[model samples]
Target: MKLARIYNVQFGKRIVTVKPDWLRVKAPQWERVGNVKEILRDLTLNTVCEEASCPNIGECFKAGTATFLIMGPACTRACPYCDIDFEKKPKALDPTEPARLAEAVRRLKLNHVVITSVNRDDLPDGGASQFIRCVEAVRTISPQTTIEVLIPDLCGHWEALELIVQGQPEVLNHNTETVPRLYRRVRPQGNYERTMELLQRSRQIAPWIYTKSGIMVGLGETNEEVRQVMRDLRAVDCDILTIGQYLQPSQKHLKVDDFITPEQFAAWKAFGEELGFLQVVSSPLTRSSYHAEEVRGLMERYPRQKVIN
Candidate 1:
């Protein structure tokens, strides 16, 4: 029996219908969304938005924004909710990927950039060095851009985490994805404690860099569970938090527990802010990289004010 059928899922008073017309206008500002696709194809690079079937891809790319996936498209882990290809033996790490990525960023003229990767548990350093190379390449090629990274847990390897932090990205993000109760269902190989530790250690190693994490609601998690996740993030001194509705990529993936209302998303955003997060983007359309420019603006403005005052 499906959970929704068995239980009367109360979505509460804030359910929002998908407004396609509004989405087209309010989406990201990719000047040439179609052109960008061709460039990515030419470089043979992959994007998480495409691979994961993220709902915000159209708006993000149309707005001239993208989250670049480095390492390779094939992942070693078969997380229940992910659509990334899973195979026993993956292709070798592309040595030229960093340079190609740098060129792509240069062409896009992106002010804020995001880089993420599939889980490469097969590698010795868990592909941390590769991530560092990509960060450095982006820095060298796009000096004016602010870079953000959404990294894997690296299976609790602090050495790998250290390498990524040393690269000096403006933001270091690793999604907790879901609450502890739903980990087995949503992210079976992930450890909730380790995920928290990754954020905690990121601050300890790179105190100046902003630490961020995101969670998806509507996976059968209760309101209290969401609150607890926020508290846990605050405990780690995470600077940013993003909450979005969970839409199942395909029928094979985990089912959508429920569709959270827009009002509920607003309530969670308010709750997160009160908990001491510097910035929170919570909505059905919110993704980790959504409104990335706003985050950079807040980070920049706060420091300048502190220095001036």
Candidate 2:
């Protein structure tokens, strides 16, 4: 499917470029890369590494770690900026996905595993059951592994949110993706307030667990708007924040507003730290779950401000 065709474009005299030199990564080499691929394929599992076309897949897979994409390769909402498919009627959830995922984790012997899924709005619980099962399976098979859940807003299902929180994930992340002004065009089915509510509720439900959020630049948002988002995240007691330069997935998706410079990313990092975030990962290739294992450690160094129940 032609999900997007807006990564780059050509002008009369100048060829517009969305990717900068700093965003380029070298080819990954190592035996683990093949091993990781073989396991994922054998089990018929999906990973955001491939689905979202992450630039760091080669590096991450080479290191024997991948962010598993559960539920499906299809999402309920068709966010123009995203690479995932826009399926109004996706296939039913696979009941055995959790077990297969757990087995793969055990086989891969990953110390830190990240589990994320496509939106399942058709389901009453917004696919939280699959998340719970995957978490439990990972705990059972590899008790030592740290499980981080990159979740959605659960389509406003509070009970479903509670279930996932009860699963006791090491890190709970719900990416805001973009600033409030761009929410309608960037994520039409998503609400900025709902995103805030998810992070706030997560912090309240599981004070010990690190709460994280992420955003992408070059979506027609100004620097001040980005700073405002960082402040908003901090207000909810968010511990970790990730900011990356948005590279339009395909030519059909949202057009790149501008290619943000590395210097700008560094400046944002400094500003985010000043806002009280434990760790601010700001770079070109910094996707929501990128280097998640290391980012989660910030919570340990920075204590929570919330009054724990």
Candidate 3:
């Protein structure tokens, strides 16, 4: 299938660049940097930032924060927008992963930690057990630390969802990368309705847990289409929403439709707040976990802030 050309907005005389300022902050204390690397090396674990080429790595690491990717680096699904390598077959699951993740958190002395994994459809439970184990491990090691998970759809496996929810993470997040019409082109194997179902069911399964979803613009989607996605998420009672500009990962991947202007992002943030999302981060460089610490603070003080359908 041929890709659609992005619509360029012709303004009066000035040409607006779609690229936003790259977000970066200084790394945290020198002592903490060595601590983070030591734990990662000890556990033989990988991080999503390095694996996916995330733009927030510099700032996050400087803040002494990191999101660990469990269940190995190879992904079963070949999503076009993602930079992670896709392997037809993957290595065996490491039973030691949970303990090592927990140890890493303890070593870093993180007040909050984010854990996510690649799609492991090859496993019987879709690596849900590994997620639970990691959460438990973190909780056991650092009882005061807040744990957040950015999860997969589990191929519509409720049993698997239950396993992760049962671990009792503070936040549960999943991304709806683009509008429904573009799903087939961008996330071909992912279903829009199923993604909604997963978010909706998460609320039903764990009413107290904060539920969140995210999207990326510049995917050849229209402004009206972005608004529609926000409404769909609100209908499912999604508590938090993140809107960001999509960056092309490689020459083999999709090209940028158009660089979204920063002003446009600010406008969208206002629109989302008006739509009743408790929290909305609409910036050109914002990713799903960009303001994770702030989100955790809001959710803690206003536990009932999240509206459930």
TM per model? Answer: 0.89, 0.91, 0.88
List the candidate numbers ranked by TM-score, top first. 2, 1, 3
The candidate that achieves the highest lDDT relative to the unseen native structure: 2
Candidate 3, 173-241: lDDT as tens digits: 999999999999999989999999999998888888888999998878988999999999999989899
RMSD of 3: 5.8
For model 2, the superposed segments whose C-alpha errors exceed 4 Å read 1-18, 299-309
Candidate 1 C-alpha error for residue 268, in Å? 0.3
Q: In model 1, which runs have C-alpha deviations exceeding 4 angstroms? A: 1-31, 304-309
lDDT of 2 by residue, 5-37 (tens): 235557885556645577889888857788899
Q: What is the C-alpha local distance difference test score of candidate 2?
A: 0.86
* Root-mean-square deviation (CA) per prediction: 5.7, 4.5, 5.8
Score each candidate by Cα lDDT. Answer: 0.84, 0.86, 0.83
- How many residue pairs clash in each candidate at the backbone level? 7, 11, 3
What are the per-residue Cα lDDT tens digits for candidate 1 across 1-309? 111222333357533333322123345455577878988999888998898878778777887788999886889999877788886567899999999998889988889889999999999988999999998999999999988999999999999999888888888999999999989878989999999999999998877888899998877999999899999999999999999877666657777667777778889989998999999999877888887767677786656221111
